[model samples]
Target: MKVTQIPFQKIGFFSKTMLDYLEKNPKINPFYNNFPDFEGFQKQIAEKQTSFSKSSRLVLAEALKNQYESFEISEKTKTNISLLKKEHTFTISTGHQLNLFTGPLYFLYKIISAINLAEELSVKFPNQNFVPVYWMATEDHDFDEINYFNFDGKKVTWNRKDGGAVGRFSTDGLDAVFDVFSEHLGNSKNAQYLKKLFADGYLKHHNLADATRFIANELFAKYGLVIVDGDDAKLKELFIPFVRDELEHGTSFKAVSKTIERLANNYKIQVNPREINLFYLGDDYRERIIFENNLYKVNNTEIAFSKDEIFKELHKNPKAFSPNVIMRPLYQEVILPNLCYIGGGGEQAYWLELQDYFNAVNIPFPILLLRNSVQVISEKQARKLAALNISKEELFLNQHELITNKVVENTAIETNFKDKKQFLEQQFLDLKEVAKKTHISFLNAVNAQERKQIKGLEKLEKRLLKAEKKRQTHLVERITILQNELLPNQSLEERQRNFSEYYLEYGITFIDVLKIALKPLELQFTILEI
Candidate 1:
């Protein structure tokens, strides 16, 4: 495999807030305590150690031990789970919804980033132990988002009427999905392996959570990736204090609302907080809990509880209360001795709004690291790209811009009017000088005419490019096909394609190639030629 690194901003896939945070802009420093760097980890380690209690650590370890009881995990993963009980151990975690067949290609990248970061951190701090964790978003209720994955330019989906948390969703409908998926995956050794993986993971497993755990562990068990499902009662018990605070004081609302107000001045806020960021969860229902008229009611439901009634319910059944996006991060931090969170652009953006909440709750905020993103191209495709003279940097441009650039490079016609526009403006400079010399009242009029002429030239230049594009339609089509191959639906491959697309071709070595190429702390986009 050959690899190239490009800055995330250059890729045009990240948000301004995420890019700004990565650059460590002083304006963002007030929102987050430490920049995610080597030295930042040192400070975060000290802070997390003081904040994460020993009892919580013990509970977390026991919970993991129970969670992994049935799965045949590697000894390395077992050791990592055992290490969580130690005071010197810290977790580097990345989380995702349980998308079928590991939805997008970035799913692998996110876990790989966490696993690689833990390994790097261990090498840096020899005395400390770092464990990679994949926190399953089992409590997520948005079934549509996690129901399908793209394969062979098609969405292989689990068609079912979904209700409640997706983790608890049955794998019954998945056998049909697996049959459809197997049809697309051609018969090869890798294909057979995938079939068995899907069969054992989904058909044999009882629920989505277990199926996802089996798949992830099958892929990354050798690397010691410990997967955790947060929908456990014992884990919910750890978050009782925050849940109680949210119910009574509306603490996340106060803190996150203020932070959003401040962040809105310079950046777009990803998520707005609710007055109560906890949801009332039932067997087949998960609804937002809204406090109104001194009564807590589940949204769109007849369920209502007074303060005393709700308090009693919470004490008896804390698992019934689920944290929303705002409080979920707090819950994750409270349960694990986590030092850093590895996530995608959107994940990091929302996390930026939470440091104030973490401060208000007096919990140590985990250092947020954007997960490693990769674009993988086959050797044949790489050769085609090279033959077309498309540079790695050129691939990041928007579809239209990339085609226009290539057309300009390939055509003999002058596609750019930049120099001509400059010269025309420079000529207007003399006209303005002449108008000024006469001191005429028509100076503004002269500038207006210049602007009009420039606008006309711009229109004419666009027309010329359009005409040229038609002349080189075949060449343009080739470039379009290439671009579409690299970026499906004009979006990042990692966002559109599934790992199975490559795993069928390269199998297990595909991951090994990625592990070799990905440098977690480098903080750049990776392009891999496989």
Candidate 2:
């Protein structure tokens, strides 16, 4: 949201294009207002439960225990937990789909947004509690996406035979990752901090769930943001009833299905329909047998669940079930005692597709907020704009369109017989009106004569404009070269290329300087060349 203005030179030229474009196009995206509406929805949610709800408390307790167990809660998580206990008026909650080594810097932006928002709300709400909660994407099924970080010129990736959930992937599998990271850190003064971060989190942890928890805990633990993994025995117990209902009535698909269909009517994006026959899983306690069409188990254990019995047990203990697609929001509602969930653009889209399911389950849908995204510019990019006589604002325009504006503005058409053509067209219009009284047929002849005259003038204008363009061909060529160098790739700063480009000038404080003026939620990446 904060940056320099477009250069003064290009602004004057773009102003004319702006005026022309405004004449032709209505200035709004047609899809802008079709957002998921909350009419009568908030009341339904508030009525469902508060943080004080039994299910909500259970979720928090389970998440805390899981995070503690996962990381061995060095003094770090303990300190963070203590801060939360002391300042429990409000908390920010941010969630991510487990990306390999935390996908992009946007992941960082999501958490930072949650944290900053919680801080803002604390000032406004004064007496209420706020805590920033990180929902560890422990259940995400994709492994290929969540396994690497691009550093320097090399991709530091996990070499593993991945299957099932990333949460349960063992930490010991990340040794090769640490080796690469250590090599990169190589004798730097801050190597120790980076090394410990990798060690206690990656090398020593057991899964993506644990490693992410450790890293988050180390950074914001002191600030009281709690990281939680949802996949745990105790946590599953909280949503046991919902889980059972999904299996019994085949409700998840049926319930969430209705929402998706309803959403398809309004939102442009359509979500995949939820499945009705859900997968059944429980600890095997008998002979090994694969149980779907048949039965299966290992180590003297057999699958002990039947669809009906699971439901019966869940009905007996609502606190014991975990909800699938139809039930997750119900479970999250029951457990988190949260007021809102801050999500990324795609995440918000999917969440919008599921509101009807929340309605079906008698759960209130949480507030869905989109995280902000941004581009960073350096001193060089800023100066380049000025030198080109292009305003900083022009950077936001499509590159080709901006080029066309520059070309048209600088081109000088020869005004050969300009007034004569305009004067003749005006005379014809005057004659057509006067001729109407003498004979209605004569009026038509006069109108045709005016049209021919206008066409001739338009043709002459085109030729003049073409010659003017030819005369300024060198300038047009220069602008095209600059446009290609500046754009072509959409990024404001080429991140994968280098940070040393800025860091050499800023030194170790480059990160601190960036974190100062910008909110973490505003921009996903930044390239600050001092």
Return the lDDT, model 1, position 10.
88
Instruction: List ranges where model 1 is wrong by over 4 Å.
Output: 418-456
Q: Can you give the TM-score per candidate against the true fold?
A: 0.95, 0.67
Predicted structure 2: lDDT: 0.54
Each model's backbone clash number: 0, 46
Q: Which window of 10 residues has the lowest lDDT sum in candidate 1?
A: 26-35
Which candidate leads in lDDT? 1
lDDT of each: 0.91, 0.54
Superposed model 2: Cα runs more than 4 Å off: 1-51, 69-90, 151-156, 171-173, 178-196, 277-305, 309-329, 389-393, 407-530
Candidate 2 local lDDT, residue 327: 47
Per residue, candidate 2 scores C-alpha lDDT tens digits across 37-141 of 233223323343343454445446545865586354446445444444332333456787666555555565567667766665556556555666888766554
